[model samples]
Target chain A: MAAVDWGTTRLRVWLVDEAGNVLAERRGDDGLITAQAAGFSTILEGHLAAMGAPEAMPVIVCGMAGSRQGWLEAPYVTVPAPIGAILAGAARVPGQRRDIRIVPGLAQRQADAPDVMRGEETQLAGAGLPAKGRHLVCMPGTHSKWVLVEDSAVTGFGTWPTGELFSVLAAHSILRHSLGEQPQPVASGNPFFQRWCEQALAEGGDVTSRLFSIRAAGLLQDLKPGDAAACLSGLLIGGEIASASRRYGKGGSVVLVASGALSTLYTEALGLAGLAVRAVDADEAVRAGLIEAARKNGMIAGSGVAA
Target chain B: MAAVDWGTTRLRVWLVDEAGNVLAERRGDDGLITAQAAGFSTILEGHLAAMGAPEAMPVIVCGMAGSRQGWLEAPYVTVPAPIGAILAGAARVPGQRRDIRIVPGLAQRQADAPDVMRGEETQLAGAGLPAKGRHLVCMPGTHSKWVLVEDSAVTGFGTWPTGELFSVLAAHSILRHSLGEQPQPVASGNPFFQRWCEQALAEGGDVTSRLFSIRAAGLLQDLKPGDAAACLSGLLIGGEIASASRRYGKGGSVVLVASGALSTLYTEALGLAGLAVRAVDADEAVRAGLIEAARKNGMIAGSGVAA
Candidate 1:
């Protein structure tokens, strides 16, 4: 059996043996957007062939591939929904050469704060649903998702476009003048970064007003370009934490599902916000989620073989 | 005498007689940024000459022309400072054919909420300081300044980059997909705009999270492109108002210093927030500011002659 996590800009695939041990893996630039134009079936076949996947090997897919504009729309399953229901309600691609199932996303249809998520649902499932108590899960990315899980069910969630907003502002807005032409990486240990996060958490609200201070600090206080970049990151991430904590009480243990630099930065920020974090590598979690889907559908054996 | 309002992207010059009568007026695209390359003196001279002003005619200039990067740095006059200090601390262009003076901007040097504003201080002076009372002045623009004037002195102010944020998100971010190619104008009367403003004011914080809803509403609710644009405007402006009101306190006579479309939109949003607005034309206010500067310096007589 094979598992795939297809998003807007990238694609990752894992080939597993009958016992669910990873035999091979592949990654490509053919995400849902590119795949839609290049032919989703063709792209999938090319990737599978590159990984030497068998013709009859069933594939379990997740993410934007199930969006309305993707290969086929996998309608959203509304919350407070059980995580396992995503696999149960998976949409099977029709008229395919090989068996392929796409996991459904979760939607919050509350009229005042309507929201939807695609790929993050799988991450949540892979993180393991908390069966006994309420848990706060933070998934940071282009669109960061702060989700609430209670007794294996996702009660509600909020999406923050922190990464996307930071990118756009850093590249195109006047804030770019403060942050130099080259993209600057925000490290957790940077004091400027830590200070900004602390300030944001302390300030509590007036985020838009605080955003202008990044530029002002640069102009008036001679803030370094690298520090400006870090400050921007800290302010955005800090605002996300503050807002999410306010909306969803910040008492529970936080499960941070992230990878690479983002994981480190978020871990540090959550610590500053006075919350203990349980870190989970996003890559492994997504693969685990895909394997879970395949196992539930009897495509892959539940027991795993030694690598 | 002549009055000039030279900002980043546009330049407006008014030729006035000694009695402060507008004899002729000219507008050009030679703003501070462009004028830096085109020669500020040449641009100012051409506009003055186009209106057939004498080379000896004294000119009172305001806005970005006084910044450190401009033709001559006027330096910032720090606040809890009187608006009249802007005129007294004006920077004069040396070695020029005409006597050109640029009004200095006001800077709030508070460690936590440091901010600076150029061009708007002249408008405040022109608007006439509120006598023996606290006035909340909302100056809406690319960098909107919500100034607190207590008994004719600027106690403090907050700058919200609402307009710039809106432009960048609508043009460069994923939110652009929901908003059409051509930039849509957000009318004051748009119900979609009104609802978003009300919602933003009601849900006072967590602005970054609310921004994501614009995209979600479009995806799930099939929000129209025009309404999406309006909602974006409402969300930003509403967020600015909410944050500013929180920082400055909502009580007081709210003076909205704006003109044309922005004036209408802000006035409507303020009204929805249950604050009665005193609308002041931004154009007239700036002109009044420049005129006040000229009159205070004895360049133009205090009394004005009707055109």
Candidate 2:
């Protein structure tokens, strides 16, 4: 069986043996936008062939490929939906020789604050959250999600534009003058990052009002570009955590599904916001989720094994 | 005498009589960035020349022309300082035949929340708030300032990147896909604007969390580009107003120092947030400020007449 995560701008594939051990792996920039133009089946079959996948092997996919604009529209499973509903709602691609299914996303259908997530749903499914208890899962990315789960079912969630806001402000806003041509990487240890993160949390997530201070500090106090960048990053991430904590109520520990830089930043920020964090690698979670979907959909044998 | 409002990206010059009545006017895009390379004196003289000003005629300038990177570095007057201090601290351009002076901006030097305003301080000087009582002035722009003025003195202020944030998010973020290439004009009457404004105020200004809803609404509900843009605008402005009202408190009426579209939007948002608005034209305020500075510096006689 093969598992694929096809997002808006990235694609990853992993081949698994019947025992759920990885046999081969492939990654590419041929995401929804590119694959839509070049053709999804063409791209998927190429990767499968390059990995020497069997002609009749089944494939499970998640992410933007399941969106309305992607290869197949896997209709959203609205919360408070059971995790099993996601596997059951998988949309099978028509006219494909191999059995290929795309996992459906989750949607919050409230009129005032509607939201939908594609790829992250699969990650949530694979996070191995306690099925019998309430849980809060934090998946930080371009659109970070703070999800509420209870008894293996998603109850509610909110998305924060933390990463996207940081990117646009750093590149297009007047703060760019203070941040310089290329912003420096923000580390968890940077004092400015820690300070602004604490400040934003203290202020109850009122961050827009403090944004201009970065530009002013650069002008009045000669704040370095790197420090300014770190400050911006901290404020955005801190604001996200502060708002999320307020909305979700900081529980004992949040399940943080992230990897690399975002994971480090969120870990530091959530700690500053007074929450313990349980770590989960996003890549592994999604692969596990796809594998689980494959087994549930009868594409793979129901072996009592965890990937 | 010539009164010039030279900012980072714009230049406005008005030739005024001793009575402070504008005799001729010239506007150009030769702002700080352009003038820095073309020579500030050269651009000033060209505008002055077009307006038919005498070579020896004195000029009173405000805004970025007085910044460290401008024609001359007019050192900031730290607040709580009187409006007169801005006029008193004007920096004269050296080695120029014309007796040109640039009014100094006001700065709040608190280490925890340092803030500075270059162009808006000049507008504050001319906003004409009651000199005997405390007042909150909202100056909407690329960087919106909610200034606390008392007895003709500026005590403190907070700058919110409301306008800039709107621009960046609309142009560079995933929201751009929701908001079309050229987003339709967002009027104050747009229900999305009114709803989001009230919502942000109700949510205590935690707007970063709601930012993704604009994107999601587009994906799930097929929100039109214009409405999405309006929602973004409302959230940013409402968040700014909410956070500002929290810090400054909702007083009787906010002195709204703005004009055009911003004037309309802020007026609407502020009203929704439970504050009556007293509107002022930003152009008139800046000109009045420059004229006031000119008279204080003796470039123009202290005429009893007001412009």
Candidate 3:
């Protein structure tokens, strides 16, 4: 069986043996845009062939490939949708010789706060959350999602444009002058980052009033561009944590599904807000999710079930 | 007498008679950058000459011209310094034929929330708030400043980058796709704007969580580009109001120093937040401020004072 995470800008695939051990792996920029232009079948099959994958190995796909503009629209399964329902709701790509199923994303259609997520749902399914009780899951990205799950069902979630806001403000806003062209990396331990994060949390996530202070600090105190960048990162991330905490309550540990730099930042921010972090690698979670979808869709045999 | 508002990217000069009536006006792109290249004296003299003003007429300048990088560094008068200090601290631009002065800006150097304002201090002086009470002055612009005035002294102020945030998000963020290249103007009566503003206020200015919903709503509900732009505006303005209210308490009517489209939008948002707005035209306020600076510096005689 082959598991593929086909997002908007990147694609990754892994071949697994019957025992669930990885046999081969491939990654590329052949995401939705490339696949749409080159043809999804051409791209997928080419990658499979290059990895020397078996001709009959069915593929379990997720992410933007399931979006309306992608290869085939895997219509969203609205929440409080059961975890198993998502795996079962896989939309099979028609006319393909091999069984190719794309996992459906989740949609919250609340009138006031309509939201939809494609790839992150697969990551959620693979996060291996507890079967019972309420859990708060934090998935930080360009658009971060704070999801609430109860009894293995997604109850509700909120999305924050923290990452995108930071990008735009740094690159395009007046703060650009203070931040310089390319800002230095902001580590979790950066004092400026921690302090600003704490301040945002203390102020109940009201950061707009404090943003201009960064530029002023640069002008008046000669604050370094690197520190200014760190302050921004802290303010945004801190604001996100504060809002999510208020919306969903600071309940125990947050299942932080992220990797690398973002992971470090969020972990630090969450801890500052008095929330413990249960870290999970995003890549592993998505792959596990695809594998689960494959098994549930009967493309692969469950461990205790007969093939 | 000549009053000049020399900001970062714009320069405006008003020729005023002894009676404080404008005789003529000249506006140009001779701001800090241009003035730096083509000597400030030359730019001022050229504008003055074009206005047919007397060669010996004294000039009173404000805004970025007072900054260290400007023509003459009119060092910031630290708060809670009285309005009189700012007027008296005017830095004289030496080596000029005329007695040219630049009004000093106000600086809040509290290590935790350091802030500075150049042109706005003049506006505050001209706003004509009650001399005894603690007044909250809301000046909306690219970097919107909410100032606290007690007696004739500026206690403190905070700057919210509301306009700049809206501009960058519309032009550079993923929301740009939903908002279009050029969104229709968002008026005060836009329902989408009102609703989002109300929501942000209710949520205690926690708008970071709601930011992505604008993008999601566009994807799911086929929200119009104009409505999307309105939603962004509402969220930012609403958040600013909410935060400022928390920081400075929703006291009596807020002194709203703004004009044009911004004045309309802010007036509506402030009403939604249940605060009365004492509307003041920004142009008139700044001009009045410059006049006040001129009178205090004796470049122009006070109505009651001897020449």
> Among all windows of ten consecutive residues in candidate 3 chain B, which has the lowest summed lDDT?
B298-307
Q: Quantify all predictions' global Cα lDDT against the true fold.
A: 0.85, 0.87, 0.88
Point to the candidate with the largest lDDT: 3
Lowest lDDT sum, 10 consecutive residues, model 3 chain A, at A298-307
* Candidate 2 lDDT by residue in tens digits, A1-307: 9999999999999998777688899999999999989999999999999999999989999999998889999999888888877776788899999999999999998888899888898898889898799899999988899899999889999998788788788888888899999997797688999999999998777898789899889877889999999999989888988888888885478999999988898899889888888999998899888888887777888842212
**lDDT tens digits, residue span B1-307, model 1:** 8899999999999987755578888888889889989888988888877788887899999999888889899898889986666566777789986778898888888877788999999988877656778888999999999999888889999889999999999999988998989767886699888888887887564478788898888877888899999988988888888888788877455899998999999989898887878988888889888988877666666643211
Model 3: per-residue lDDT, tens digit, B1-307?
9999999899999999887799998899989989889988898899999999897999999999888889989898888877766776788888888989999998898888989999999988888887788889999988899999888889999998888888888889888998999987798699999999999988777778888899889888889999999999999999999989998997467999998999999999999999988999988888888888888877788832211
Q: Tens digit of lDDT per residue, candidate 1, span A143-226?
A: 999999888889999999999989999999888998999966886699877888887776553478788888888877888899
What CAPRI class is candidate 2?
A: medium
Q: Spell out the clash pairs found in candidate 3.
A: none
List the candidate 3 regions with Cα displacement exceeding 4 Å.
A303-307, B303-307
Instruction: Enumerate residue pairs that collide in model 2.
Output: none
Interface RMSD of each: 1.4, 0.9, 1.0
Off by over 4 Å in 2: A303-307, B303-307
Each predicted complex: what DockQ?
0.70, 0.79, 0.79
Off by over 4 Å in 1: A303-307, B302-307
User: First chain of model 3: TM-score?
Assistant: 0.96
The per-residue C-alpha lDDT of model 1 at residue A291 equals 83
